[model samples]
Target: MDKETEQLIEKAGKVYSENFSMTTCFERAIFFSWWCGINDCGFCFMSALPKEKTAKETAIRHESSILAETWLCRKLGWEFGFFTGGINAFNADKIESMLEKINKVYGEKVWISLGPIPKKLLERYKPYVKGVVGSVETINEDVHKKACPSKPINPYLKMFETANEIGMKTAMTLIIGLGETKDDFDKLVNFIKKYHISKIHIYGLIPHKGTVYSDADIPSAEYQAWWIAKTRIEFPRIDIQCGIWSDRIERTSLLLKAGANSISKLPVFRKFGTKISYDLEEQTKLAGREFLGSLTKMPEIDFDEIDRFGFDEELTVKIKDKIKKYLNVMKKN
Candidate 1:
């Protein structure tokens, strides 16, 4: 076995030794916030901080804004909170300041999901953050840049390196409908085997209203479930979970059965986190109603529908070809 594999096995042994539930103790994405515009990834959510026109002007100051966000999370009764943002957009000062405000206001109730960060930054935030999620988004750099105009912000491979050096349990996100072939996805999954990534979040491409890849075809449930299952076997010790897999609950449940253990529920809507600034309760309620409606419609788990997504001929052929190529490449290398 390779040195990485050997280490992973040792780590897994140490991990499974604990009594944490693979499913129950698995964390949830209580409040998710990002700091950039749509990248190459299908999702287009960004942060709500200072910038040019792209940024939203808030009534509150930065530190207070952060404290408010944390307080809202506590009030909403979320276990963990995620701070998703562009790697380039965040700085050590901003992170440090944010953490201090959060800790001072909310104490130690929520976790932060700071995106790909530097080793020093990670160490600085180590005490405040419960965990980190340096999602390379996609392993393919070409696809990554094309999707995220912020090229070089969160380079796919550099994230893995930083995660290892930081000595923090990490999380990754995969965009399933980013035009990657079966081989590409498999290669990425196999590549992820060499990290301290404790969670794998799978998000189907949700065409934002305005973005380059909005109209692209989203991956089928069958494709994602198979990928999740295959990944579970390949990286048996890792934690896997569906991220924003709301559109395909059946497939998501199949993935959960295969090995995924975490889910990111919808965040309660607030004017502070929206695209506009308004103190009017009516406007807030209007947005809140829409947001709550969307959250309520999230798909429920259905095992029977998942079972119907049988391994058809096309998928079987694709998966087999990819697996064979993977093995051959590994042998050659």
Candidate 2:
């Protein structure tokens, strides 16, 4: 590892030693996007689609990059790593081959956050992955369609459903501040409950300069805190995550207090010609929280026992009622 990465690991270890005992759900992990391809999702600002590469060439590059990231994750002592990128009609055979290679070489410590994937392809890829994330961004179909015109919400939902059915650890991401209302959030909570999703990543939109929603309003820290608290209460056992995009120290600290337990895509090493990102560790320190290493084992989830509001109907009603009351108060103020 380079000097910078070494220093980061040491600092993270110190933070972990100091804070791990006090927290119940404070874990951290890193992610890499091998092919930062062009996404038709109009809300993205960070996409840089490769123009000159062929499908086979792109597949090779992505596999090699993922292997390197796996090595870095192991060296840095992170317990989990993620493969993320834009939606492309990638060759299923090539993608599966790459995933199989990564699993064989690095073990099942990697997860993927690719957008919508076909059910057959997803099933073929399931055993090679630790988890699969199909981020719905928001539960409001209108907002979702408007934000991601090229990508429909139904396919994303199907991806999650299929992953769950295949016994693949499933996760989702919801972006706050995208014109979604409290009712939308409630719908998201209900969907997660219905699916028994293993993890949920909540991010506030960071309008990039080139994105269609560049001039969009950022959600308030207070609103984010409220949302996080609501999600925690609604899904008490699920791993709620905050990302580097929402890494302001005070804001992150508030999120932790509000029941967020993990931070994802922590920059441990530089790749894809981007600068080394270490905001997660710094944020953890500023939050005065422990930096628990990446996920070691999948949390045991009893899918059969998880009631789709049958067992927790009263709790669900109470939480939604509380959220409605709180939103009313905010509106009044």
Candidate 3:
């Protein structure tokens, strides 16, 4: 590693250790994306770009990016890692192959948010994945349809049901401020009670520039906090997470008091123009929660083992170059 990279790693390690009380905990998970293009979801802030490669080539790149992210997660002492891309149909074979590889290295330490998938496919990959997130975004069908024109609400609910039936840990996200009413929360609570979801993520919608919803109004922190507290009261045993996008310390502090016990997808390094206001440790401290480290005891991982996960030399070099750029940019800033 170069000097800048070394500094970042050291700083992250020290801050992580100081903020968190345990060596292994579920809250110490990181988030990365396997794909950046749109998945035909109109409400998505991410825009679709023209396809540059065949399906096979795109699949390879996705797998390679995931492997590289895994290596970074291991180095950061995070207990869990998740992949997020907007709802898109994936090549099932390619995704299965990628999950199998990740399971070998991390052993169910990873989760993924794929909008909605088939039941058979979920069952096939359930053993390799720790959890699956099928975000309905809103319980109101009309509101959901308005936000995501291409994706329907019923299938997403079905995906969660299928996950529960197969005994896979399941999660769902509710984005507040999408013109949803109190009735929507009641509907969601009933669904959660019936489905036995292991976790619930609450995020305030960010009106990204150039998106269809860019002109939409942002929800107040107080409004977001109220629902978060309500969810905690309704589901005392389940994990409630404040997502990365809702980053204000004041909001997060209230969320913790109202019963949020976890946070997800903290970045290991801050890139330019990123909106991250606090690191994992800082967020945990703000909420007066203990920051836990890894969830399992294991020997140190060998870096060379990453090569065995399957990536072409060109892809491997590309990932390395990206990492170097990330570190150098942070150093300059």
lDDT to native, each model: 0.49, 0.58, 0.60
Candidates 1 and 3 compared by lDDT, better number: 3
Candidate 1: residue pairs that collide: 34-46, 34-47, 34-84, 35-47, 35-85, 39-147, 39-148, 40-147, 40-148
Give me the overall lDDT of model 3.
0.60
Q: Largest lDDT belongs to which candidate? A: 3
On TM-score, the stronger of 1 and 2 is: 2
- Candidates sorted on lDDT, descending: 3, 2, 1
Please give the distance, in angstroms, between residue 9's alpha carbon in candidate 3 and its true position after superposition: 36
- Where model 1 places Cα greater than 4 Å from the true spot, the runs are 1-77, 86-91, 101-115, 153-156, 245-247, 265-333
Pick the TM-score winner.
3
CA shift of 159, model 1, Å: 4.5
How displaced is residue 29 in candidate 3, in Å?
Answer: 8.6
Give the range where candidate 1 is weakest over 10 consecutive residues by summed lDDT.
289-298
Residue 195 in candidate 3, Cα distance off native in Å: 2.1
lDDT at position 200, candidate 3? 80
The candidate with the higher TM-score, 1 or 3, is 3
In the range 1-333, model 2's lDDT, one tens digit per residue, is: 345433433444343334434342232332233344446555675343444556324433334345444433443345553566545535667667657655654556567777777788777887778788876787888888877776677877788788778878888888887789877767877888777787888878877677777889878666676667677665556677765453343466556656677654332232211222234444556656666542222222222322232324553344344434433433332
- Sort the candidates on TM-score, descending order: 3, 2, 1
